[model samples]
Each structure stands twice: as C-alpha cells, then as structure tokens.
Target: MKDKLFKNLLHNAKGYSVLNSGGQLVKGYKPDTVLQKGNEYIIMECDTGTSRKGYLGAMLKAARFLSNEKKGVLVLVIKEKPNTKVKQIAEHLQEYLIWLQPLTNLNIVYLIESNRYCPDENPLELLSSEFITTATIIKSD
Candidate 1:
C-alpha cells in the first residue's frame, strides 16, 4: 500500500515490483499484490490500530522513493470525518514520517466518504493539486 500509493500506482493502477537492498523483497523474494484500479492496495493499513505502525518502516522507504521521484501529494482515501480513527492515524503517521524521514517533501490528506471505498458517483481526481481538498465520495441516501 505504501509503495504503491507513493509510486502513484493507486492513481494510475500501474504494475510495480518491490525490490530489496539484497535484491529481494519480503514474502520469500516474491512480489506483492497485483495492481487493481479503485481497489485499495491495502484496506486496513490506515486504521487507528493494528497495521498503522506497519506503515512506519514502509512509509520511510516509500517517502525516500517518492522524494526521488518528486511526488509530494500523499493522500489517504478515508470514509469521512468525525472519524477519530482516521484523524488519529493521520496525525500519528504525519509525525512519524516527519521524524523518520525529515527530508521528505510531501503533504498528507485524509479524504473522507460516506462509502467504505470510492464509488461510481465520484472517483479520485487527478488534476487537483491541493493537498487536503474534501471530496464527496458517495451519494446521499
């Protein structure tokens, strides 16, 4: 999730390979999940607990790669606000990333929706340059 998102794969659904310094990624030198448009590279990594920290190391690695690529817009598609969970995770990750990769040039956004994921009515826009713009992701019931 971290690598794919930072690599802009989430935006373009491009294929990616996770390589290690020893020339092998984890999972026994196997590749990670296949890319799929509009499906979360990870569905639970951004939650307040259980897997948020899993991102710290990954975030640092991703940030380094992104900085090399000059990508600064780090977005998290969330289900909406008053989501203390999202907010907490955002703050924690923001701080951790700052301290861990202080040279990273990027901004993070916790995007919200009424739906669990992106729906047909609205999809993530590629033209927007703003870091934290609010977007409507679901239709009203």
Candidate 2:
C-alpha cells in the first residue's frame, strides 16, 4: 500500500522528467526515479528501510559520475514519519552530502520525508523548493 502510494506520487511530479528505474531491470543499483532539471540530474532514491548503506553507496557513485557531466542532487525520500532510525539515516546522508559536495561540486543535497507532502502534491515541487532555495542562496553569494 505504502509503496504504491509513493510510486504514484513520484510518477506525478511536474517540471521534471522522472525516470522510473525501480523496475530492477539492472542489477545492484536501481533508484526509484532520476529527475532532470535544467543542468541538474537528481537521483531520487525512495526507500522503506532507513539503514541501507550499501544501496546508498551505489547511488552515491552514480551521483558522482552524473555530477561530472552535470549538476547532481541525491534526493532521498523516505516513506515514513520521523523516527530514531530515520533520523540516524538522515544524519548519515548529511555526512555523505558534506563529503561528496566538494568532491562532486554539487549545488545541494535534499532529504525529504514523505509525510511533509500531500498525496495530491507533485513530488517535484518539493524537490524544486529545495533546489530553488539553494540556488537563490548560492547566487546571492
């Protein structure tokens, strides 16, 4: 139920070409969607588990390569409300973001929890909010 709900929401995101790569056509690394916004390539990894370091590592590698070609943002959307496990995962993601940003030269990294959005809201709107806000701040600097 949860999975299908989130899948539909991601499928409906606007202003971004959302690729549903979660079909697992490939081995090892399959993210929920890949979003292209201008010069940016956002790999959206939607997960039910909070502690999936192996999976995250693979996504990070993909993001690194994509960033070299274009700007990158790893938008990790976890499908549950805030909890200790999720908090820990978010912190780990942030740590990786800090480490990878300089290496990847990415503009920003976003970690959004599913509870923040209405089912009717486009998922891209949430992603754009973060990127737009970050771009504004970056431009001002």
Candidate 3:
C-alpha cells in the first residue's frame, strides 16, 4: 500500500515532484514521501496500524518540519478510521500548533476499502485515484 501511494504521488500526480522518498533522511527525519509543487511542499507518511508511538512520532516530526519551513502540508494515510485516542491526540496537537495552522495543514487520508456491490473494484484504485484527488483538494485550499 505504501509503495502504491508513493508511486502514485511520484508518477501519476501532476504538478508534483518528488523531493525525498524511500525513507531518505531530510533534516534528521525520514518522511515516507515528500513532494513539491512550485514553492509548496508536502510531507506524507503511511500508518500501517502497528504502533501508536510511531504515529505520534510522525506527527511530531511533521509539526517540527512545518514550524521550520513555514509551508507545506502533512498527510498521514491510514488503512482505516483512527480510533478515539488517535483523534484526541491529533486534536491536541493541532491546538498546540495553532500558530502554524495558517501556513501549514495536517490532512488525514483514510484508505478504507469499499465493500459495496462493485465486484470489479480494485482495492488499490483508492490509493491511485482518491489520494491524488484528496491531495489536489488540499493543495487548492
């Protein structure tokens, strides 16, 4: 899933160029993927539903990066809806970093697979299609 997302962002997504990726270190942090569109940058990380500690670290790193750069958006992609605790943590972080809210944004993308009647739906389609759509909206805003 992470691979697909990276590929989509690096190749399929228009107007975006890959800056750092594949766990490459950037300013002492290794974001899963970083993209640039003009002067704006985006830092992305994928949560594999493994550890909350790791997720928290990613959020903190994003906050730090934004605080320093004063631009870009942090995108955290998850396989399902975040639990209550995760939501609370995110809210608190946002409140604490309210000053950076205008210059940067934290966007969460839930990649929940549809279980509806569509038999031909490819599960990876969401990563390829919805991700770019979401990113485009975020960038536009």
lDDT of each: 0.36, 0.54, 0.50
**Which tens-of-lDDT digit does each residue in 39-109 have in candidate 3?**
55666666556465665677667766664444566665554444623344454444434544454444432
Per-residue CA lDDT of model 1 for 22-113, tens digit only, reads 22233333222222223122111222223556445445544543444454333344433353445555555766655645565443423343
- Order by TM-score, highest first: 2, 3, 1
lDDT score for residue 10 of model 2 = 45
Residue 35 accuracy (lDDT) in model 1: 26
In candidate 2, position 21 carries an lDDT of: 53
Winner by TM-score? 2
Residues forming the 10-long window of minimal summed lDDT in candidate 2: 132-141
Measured by TM-score, how close is model 3 to the native structure? Answer: 0.54
Q: Rank the candidates by lDDT, best first.
A: 2, 3, 1
Q: Name the candidate, 1 or 3, with the larger lDDT value.
A: 3
Top lDDT model: 2
Q: How many backbone clashes does candidate 1 have?
A: 2
Tens-place lDDT digits, model 2, residues 8-110: 6644335667655565423555666666667666666566664557435744765565545676556566655355243556555555555666557454545
- The C-alpha TM-scores of every prediction are 0.44, 0.63, 0.54
Off by over 4 Å in 1: 1-49, 78-84, 109-117, 126-131, 135-141
